[model samples]
Target: MNTNVTPLTTVSRGGDAVLFAIEMRGKKLTCSITREALEAHFWLERQANEARLLRAFSDGRKRIVAIAERKARRLATEVIKLTSQDFER
Candidate 1:
């Protein structure tokens, strides 16, 4: 779609995942990646705090959003959730 993803300000804990958002073409899409995914894919610690998790997310933001966009395109959904399996080749 030739759109860029801009991360939203608010990030929250959603059970075992971190809930966040990304704006694409003026629309905000809810996105999340599991704690397990973060640990396995983003170099996050298993017992990380929220700050650490946020840092890991920020560091890997580009790759994360790219995958999310692909998932959104394939699934045609407004919500994108990433699990550890999403990272497996």
Candidate 2:
């Protein structure tokens, strides 16, 4: 239960509330991600954004993968920080 361990979330059932699991230090923290106090939110926007990025870089091959991997890392860090706050509640 070390506060220092970063929480990594995997979101599911995205439609008003998301069922999510956060793992850290070989342990998992389960929680919900709500939209406007509701239990699910549509993930279409996120999917569309990722699709757009992929289409735009369709020809970039290794370059695109590298860039995307970096972006993924940054996004993962951001999400970990965001979800970590849920533990306070």
Candidate 3:
């Protein structure tokens, strides 16, 4: 993980939504959001995102959940990529 990336939040679940943040190599890329409205899309996105994250981290470990922000709800169907290294220390 980069020393410049800062994670605004980790994993947050409430009501029917999940929220979190993505930091890579020490830089905040963007916030993410997952909710019922975009559950299907979010799931798919999460798969790809996790895959990339895994490769980037490549620690042979797995991420338990996806991170997102409430505002990202609108971009659920779009593609989003993140890595553990992005978070700042």
> Which candidate tops TM-score?
1
Q: How many backbone clashes does candidate 1 have?
A: 0
lDDT of 3 by residue, 10-31 (tens): 3333323233334443434453
Tens digits of per-residue lDDT, candidate 2, 39-75, equal: 1112223334434322322332233223323333555
- Relative to the true structure, candidate 3 reaches a TM of 0.26
Choose 1 or 3, whichever is better by TM-score: 1
Give per-residue CA lDDT, model 1, range 1-89, as digits (tens). 55565555334645367777776656778888888888999999877778888888888887888888888888888888988887788
Q: Which scores higher on lDDT, 1 or 3?
A: 1
lDDT of 3 at 76: 52
**RMSD (Å) of each candidate, 1 decimal:** 2.1, 12.3, 11.8
Q: Which lDDT values do the candidates have, in the order given?
A: 0.78, 0.32, 0.33
Model 1: ten consecutive residues of lowest lDDT = 6-15
Off by over 4 Å in 1: 4-11
- Tell me the lDDT of candidate 2: 0.32
